[model samples]
Target: MGDCVIEPEQDYKGRVGDDPPPYIKMPQNIWPKDAPFLREGLYNYYSHVFPLAMKLVRIFALAFGLEEAALDGIFKFPITGMRALHYPPMPKEECGTIGLGAHTDFSWLTMVLQDSVPALEILNKHGQWVQAAPKPNSFVCNVGQYLERQTNGRFVATVHRVRNQTGERRYSLPFFLTPDPDANIHALDSFIAAGERPQYEPFNVGDLYIRRVLPARHRHPTSVKYRDVPESEWKYELLYG
Candidate 1:
């Protein structure tokens, strides 16, 4: 996994100024141009991890009597990508917010592999944060916006955060899986028919991607308004508001 750190020629320091830190792309054909790490990661995820995730998703779908493929079309091309993250040791004074801020992923699914460290936490419905401990050879999975939309309020996209509380350096690999750029994301009819009404309005995955790629302050105004709301809240508001 360390071999994946293909640094880009230009440092990302000056590019974004002081928002979220800059991300450095791999230097070599670490992700071959033709393959575009996005595609490569998707391939690897589908081959190695999708079965497990899909099994869980399928069970949830069956509870609603929805076909397995009800969610398949949404994952076509599955914009999956790997993020190699390194959190430096924190100073005693700034120990409170050492890792990442509280936020949820923007994709359909996220599979994380932690290396001998525990830094992730999930926010429950009551808004309390709970630490997510590392399990041996097991990956941490979280639902994302696309799936939350497709499930029509059946499944959820939960809130999560990361913090290096032990005053130690940390490294992690998060594999993000998303819908194809051109795919349309909306509540599935079967889900709606079996469950409650669709919670979110129909939206194109490409449009969401564009908004996500831009700076948070620069994202579409409507999207910014509900950035901190739970997926359930945003799903309804985005659909009707």
Candidate 2:
């Protein structure tokens, strides 16, 4: 492996944004960098990643007791987002502090390609942090909030955080597969028993993105409209950072 390089953010001036951009982002590839056109690699990964994600969704659908093609409509016009991230080495002084905060992804699913420099961790049922180190070229996949809502919480979405204690720079690529903008997400009728009740109110794909997700400090601009429905009434809804 090549020795990792750590560059001071000041050298890049406005190029790196005010707060190092919360980890290197592939935000529609709009962010600037030394190699601005370095998007070919991302596209290369997406070519394979998207199809794999779709295939996995069908498999999950069957496992969750729904027909294999149950998710076909949602996948027909899905918005699959991909990102390539780079987290520079943290100083020894702030090693314990958070590099990336904890939050649950609202997408249907997320797959990560992590490098040797470790940082990712997930919050387990016991509320303890668990390290998720990389292994060769294998990708780490996580269940997301949408999948949980659709399953009536059958498969809970994981809450994960990142910290870069390694003296070397850390890199990872995460691809998120989300439903079509206008499609609605709800627990399937087939999963409910005669006396069982549905845990959540049906919501459109846009509600989770616009209302809950967009209010973050480093905003992700989107055209999706927000719903006034308070997250409290929806027991299944989870807030975002």
Candidate 3:
């Protein structure tokens, strides 16, 4: 785990007592040179899924009542990060016990491929934890903060986590899609009514990734250094936990 963001003894930021979930994060820029089998498998998956992801992006643009290519420029080169997560059995614990802490994806979109294990759970509007059981040959897709902000909170990002209670190992692969680094993040004019104000501030995509996203997972907090970015420049309202 030398290169992993969080160590085995470490906990996810703000999650004091919970253990960091076991996972291998694969950035699109890196590949395992020695592990041909694993590398090839992931490459195959990426090749097939990337085109489909673009189609989904276009669909989302159309859904937002914008031109089909409205979002094409920003997502021309997306930050596609994948995670291979493993949750071991803990049958003695209650089903609702957290395998992964509650959190929302701050990226653009996420598609999760799960094994035949009922571990993933999502928080519903009624404030209840609903099981996201695995369906054969299907994926669970959800929007993220980026889209929510772009749409001025029209598309809500789902809050989700994992809970292992089946006395069996649970595995999942989540592919995260984020905008290109230089893209600007702001609410579209179409999303706001006349005389209404936009709810979010404009910020560069890369700046947020470096300042907010990286620091939370850094092995040494000081490893991620940033200039004096004003608090207002990056802070945004989170409607859910």
Candidate 4:
């Protein structure tokens, strides 16, 4: 459907964090015209998840010893993006076997809906990759890099990957929730105590998004849009890692 689909080749330039595998991404505008159910289904799911995510944001702030309303203003104008991903079977003996490479999501939170296939694996605290088995009718939510940065390692951004060894096509819908574009993302004062340094410098969410995305999408490095983001702040590793 239209231009919403980001082909694998279009995203092969930068392999900073994850070696993105082949998958189709359909945002709302380019949802299939023939499959009305798809558009409606995604819309319905988004409606339910948005409120849940907002609630989670406040809860996370409170859990980290801050006031419940501390993180509220940043999300006043949230940027919600959803992707319907289809990962075909990749038999270990025949192919590379990685459906999606390991990486921490770039958003504040990522809610994933799996179609009951055990392809998702998360790197646990013990440094082991464990299966995140699907439970019926429930979403698996993961903290993303943005939250990890804001909390200054108090809440880790888990590293996760996908491998379709089930020998069947795997379908998943992941919803990414991010703060407003103009919001500044920085480690909270509560996270940085006296004599301790902040893990990351303050930066605008919009500029960070542009720097991280343009290269990944194989856009020309010399584009005027890149001038807005300084070279010091151009790479995702500098911003989140």
How does each model score on TM-score? 0.65, 0.75, 0.78, 0.76
lDDT of 2 by residue, 30-65 (tens): 444776456455556666776788789899879877
**RMSD of each candidate?**
11.4, 11.2, 10.7, 9.9
Better of 1 and 3 by lDDT: 3
The digit string of per-residue lDDT tens for model 3 on 133-209 reads 99999989988888888889888899998877776878888888888665788898889999999888887886676
| CA lDDT for candidate 2 | 0.67
Off by over 4 Å in 2: 1-37, 217-241
Predictions in order: lDDT:
0.62, 0.67, 0.69, 0.70
Candidate 2 vs candidate 3, TM-score winner: 3
In TM-score terms, candidate 1 sits at 0.65
Highest-scoring model, TM-score: 3
Clashes of 2: 0
